[model samples]
Target: MKAWQHLQREPGSAVADPDVLQVINACAPRPSPTLMRINGRVVIAYSRTRAFIDRDAWEALPSDGLLLLRVWPRGTSSSWFALTRPELERTFDEVRKTRSWNSVRHYHFRVFPAALEAFRVCMTRDEAPFASQISAAEAGSESEKRGSPVSPSH
Candidate 1:
């Protein structure tokens, strides 16, 4: 991003206190630390089909807060949609545009607050993000079991 480019240009200069929000894309190998100058926290992740698993971790940040979108720009892109230069400039806005009736993916990973224990409780060093898609199917089954009057849109 522009901020990283700016910082890269001035390697010796004292970087400002971080005000960052991090985003790790799907199938990412790892989160990049260079993009995390603002707020100085990492938020590498993949969103589940129906939810942002880390939602409560940063529920209070605004859409435009600083972000470190950790997507692949080399080789095959790990993100469902790789961001272009113009899109990165307005990533939050562009990501919000991806919102729809059943989609939970977007580039709106701005705001890097200190890590929350609640957010880490379910995850461990060995577990992978989202873990699996069985939950999505389970949700549908549960809905059927409840016999809700309105059917799911999907």
Candidate 2:
């Protein structure tokens, strides 16, 4: 069954990747109890705008279970689908003609084997945290790093 499991204030599991784990970290408010069982199928989302699955939650999934992931490009009609192996070849043939990474504003991913493995090994690296206040020097440096203008008040 598909359900939206709300994250807890404290993590129910440590096996999830740290960034994914951060969805329930001390700094963030817990929305609800985490689903511990991966029976059949389960999914966890961060917010309505954008989210990815928790690795620990993914790990709990029975390996043999079938997975299907669909990604939609923001402001575009084209959608990407990745099904289990037997259906993958056909999906790829379809993807080649329509998918363009450079045009993607937002992406949706399917959580089957190859995609899951990629998420496991290629999750995002550490990013700078946002602060309530930024000094002139800090803002200037950040602007240089991003190759864009950053104001101290930002």
Candidate 3:
């Protein structure tokens, strides 16, 4: 599923191209994680296979707010997950602590295929961590807008 498509469906959310953030690395543009704002919170939306996830690029996202990852496994439907900055940091810290790198500069964080399901519950559950963080009024409104738990946009 396209990452921003979900955000676009949210009544009060604003979805914009990654260029809006103008994030670049060493003169080259980083990968996609369309910028979005929902319920007055910023969210970086990523839609890609595990292998394409760029730790450096993601780490560059705003220190506050969530990273919305739509990790699609090979030949399978995508799953939606929202990670707070702290949660993302912890995962990155583990990679650094363990030195789990494919090479000198490439490391595989725990947010890979094996851990995708664990993250899915972060945003797709009834009391979704991310959703619950919203105010009661917003929660009720959003729940009404989205009658079911956030599911993969297949």
Candidate 4:
């Protein structure tokens, strides 16, 4: 919800999705790209429940739009990542070549903390400035200072 609000505040920005209400109200974790945005360029936004991404979601990604990934662990602060279409496709190809499908027949692309260094525009990096300073537990304090959009109790 904060991501959506932040995006909408940008000039020339517009966002939409048929399932936004469902996504927002969902009680369980789900694959994402919950909304689409046009801010000089089109972007598909996904607020992920974990650092890992499913192959089904990757394959379903649209070729024409950029991806805005929000990695938010439950009860923790979130980080933002802006992935280009080519990068998203390239990563999927790389994952397919080196990783095997699980029993469910889908590849799992996991982005553990160290791997986050490879992504562009990760908000956590911006906030911490140094990897040593990066801590999810501490993120809440920063969010509070910045006036978190979500209620404190949430």
Candidate 5:
């Protein structure tokens, strides 16, 4: 079975989330072999041979959106699949024609890997605590690098 199919089988899988479903429905005329998955707060969209979002657009998403987490296979080239307004369809068409197999594979493996890892991690424990721990650790590291000391009380 396809990886996407496997992911969809779980009860709380992102595939079943209402928000994601809404987005998928709005996106219209679903493409074959689904390349996107939406969890409560995040959206994972893939392109067969390229990444779905460009860096500038990605950086613009609010923390809540967290769009396009992983690209499959790793080391993939990325471009914007969803353009603003009038250019959307034309941009998608341009991408469909220019994307390569290797590029797509890289996107599938790399960009989405972190999200997949997070899902696996979430399945094992109360993800909020773990996520908090990770955030704390990252903040600590950042503080250290800046030559600042973090106090436990803070």
Candidate 6:
């Protein structure tokens, strides 16, 4: 069975969105995205869905790669997760460190097949600048922040 099939059978099985599934399929090495909602706000958007895996599965995978995790609020729409290279040894460790994770009740990790070297380069050269831009825009004004939605936790 596909990983997604197994996910659907899990205890909290929420239907993965079609768009999310498409992105996951098109993006090599990344797991299918998981959808979730928190409080009343949609903190995490649909594009940020992620897959969850057990520790054993995580450890068995290749060492050099990117992993994406999605976290959601208990009753709101806001949620987020980390996408990092060099598989996270402990998902909870990083989650606990984030402000949004403080109130999160649901989450999953999505592993990506990427070389550590490439991932590092991408993060430093690509993602870092993009993140800075978003931060700057968000800091500039409430209107801009509201207009530019943050990616879902993952």
TM-score of 6: 0.25
RMSD value for candidate 1: 18.5
Off by over 4 Å in 4: 1-30, 60-64, 97-113, 120-154
Off by over 4 Å in 1: 1-65, 74-91, 99-102, 107-154
TM-score of each: 0.21, 0.21, 0.45, 0.45, 0.27, 0.25
lDDT, residue 92, candidate 1: 26
Give the per-residue lDDT of model 4 (tens digit) for 55-100. 4445544566555556677899765545555655544444555336
Question: Poorest 10 consecutive residues of model 6 by lDDT?
Answer: 5-14
Worst 10 residues of 4 by lDDT: 143-152
Query: What lDDT does each candidate get?
Result: 0.25, 0.25, 0.41, 0.40, 0.30, 0.29
Q: How many residue pairs clash in model 4?
A: 0
In model 2, the clashing pairs are 16-56, 69-110, 71-108
Over 1-154, each residue of candidate 2 has an lDDT whose tens digit, in order, gives: 1111211122112223443333323222122213321333332322121223223223333433222222323564321211223222322223323344124322233432222222221123442122211243244532110011111221
For every candidate in turn, the CA RMSD to the true structure comes to 18.5, 20.1, 14.1, 13.3, 18.1, 17.0
Native RMSD of candidate 3 (Å): 14.1
User: Taking the tens digit of each residue's C-alpha lDDT, what string does model 6 give over 30-52?
Assistant: 23332222232221122233333
Instruction: Estimate candidate 2's alpha-carbon lDDT, on a 0 to 1 scale.
Output: 0.25
Candidate closest to the true structure, highest lDDT: 3
**Which regions of candidate 3 deviate over 4 angstroms?**
1-31, 51-53, 96-116, 121-154
Can you write out model 3's per-residue Cα lDDT over 29-133, one digit (the tens) per residue? 123545555455555655565533445435555676656655566799755555566655543444544344334333433333332233443221243333332
**What shift in Å separates residue 46 of candidate 4 from its native position after superposition?**
2.2
